[model samples]
Target: MTETESKARVAKFHIGQVVKHRIFPFRGVIFDIDPVFNNTEEWWLSIPAEVRPRKDQPFYHLYAENAETEYVAYVSEQNLLADTSPEPIRHPQVREMFVRIEGGAYRPRDLRVN
Candidate 1:
């Protein structure tokens, strides 16, 4: 296998899964995934060096929320943990992009027309 292939790490999460920051007070649902970091260099550098994540792991795009507000967040896989809250996510965009399944996980809206 090529060096890159050998080093590749599979994402531990999936689209529509609810997750929360490992060290932050926010939670969100995964709406997209990047197999590796794909953001600007400045954005990466802005993170404190002690806490910045490596660029080789999957990154997720989330419809995120904290106690008082909601926003979009781009988070590395290492910083996320499965959010086990029984309450559904309250981000407004979540309703537009997904539907809650029976067990509380969200699923993408089926946009294909018959």
Candidate 2:
């Protein structure tokens, strides 16, 4: 295996799963995933040193919301936690991209082509 492959970590979460920042006060449903960091270095460095996450782990794109408003977020797996709240996310894009399953997790809306 390649050296990069050997160091790769499996993502602990999946697209359409609801999650929250480990320290922030917001929650969202994952809409995309990157196996490793794929963003600009400036963005990575913008985070406070004590809270910054390593780039080798998975990163997620979320349609995120807090009590007052909604926005998109790019977050690292190490900085996230599964959101077990029975309440659904209020981000409008979530409905456009997913469906809530019976167990309270969101699932991607099937977009099969015939």
Candidate 3:
């Protein structure tokens, strides 16, 4: 396998799963998934090399919130784990994209990527 192919991993989470950053203290619901890194190079370069994720792994687009702010986060699969908090997420945009939070997952509304 090519180096990138050999390193690629199947995404462990899915759209609508709640997850937390493995290193950071933010939590969010997955709204989108990229099979491989697809963000701008400038964004990639902004992360310190020592902590940057490899491009071959799955990347998630999340509706994320922290104590101080709410925003979307593009995170690597290696940097996320399932969120176990009983509290619900409060990111404002989640209601626009999901039908409801049921059980431990968010139910997505009809998705359009235009």
Candidate 4:
């Protein structure tokens, strides 16, 4: 993270809260927090990483959910808007099912008889 990047993550918010990327218009639950490097500055949030435009800067990247797609986005910290609305946490079993499916442990099979 660059000197400016480090100084851009201090926010007036806490983790596990809901936030929205103002530029991308995507919303997600806060996963991580970043400290400011310089003066009292903005805070960073971990946007769920995606396959495109991969970068190492945390303040410039964010994870958000659009419908069913979970993608990573690169946006400035100033562009991140705090969402005060409470969001329901994902059920453990449901999350496990998704993991299984994504890991290829759960595959669809053809059951039609010839």
Name model 2 segments beyond 4 Å from true: 1-5
| Model 1 stretches astray by more than 4 angstroms | 1-6
- Tens-digit per-residue lDDT, 4-107, candidate 2: 55677999999889899999999999999998888999999999999989888899999999989999999999989999999998898888889999878988
Task: Give me the overall lDDT of model 1.
Answer: 0.94
> Model 4 lDDT vs. the true structure?
0.44
- In model 3, the runs with Cα more than 4 Å from the true position are 1-7, 110-114
Q: For model 4, where is the 10-residue window of minimal lDDT?
A: 36-45
Index of the highest-lDDT prediction: 1
What digit string (tens of lDDT, one per residue) describes model 4 on residues 1-114?
775565453465444345676656477544445543221222222344442222222343334576557764434455567765455324232232222233222222334579
Task: Indicate which candidate wins on TM-score.
Answer: 1
TM-scores of all candidate predictions against the true structure: 0.92, 0.91, 0.87, 0.41
Task: State the lDDT of candidate 1 residue by residue for 38-95, as single tens digits.
Answer: 8999999999999999888899999999999999999999999999999999999999
Which of the predicted structures, 2 or 3, would earn the higher TM-score when compared with the native? 2
Kindly list the per-residue Cα lDDT of model 3 for residues 9-112, writing each as its tens digit. 88899999999999999999999999889899999999999999989999999999999999999999999999988788899888888865657678888777
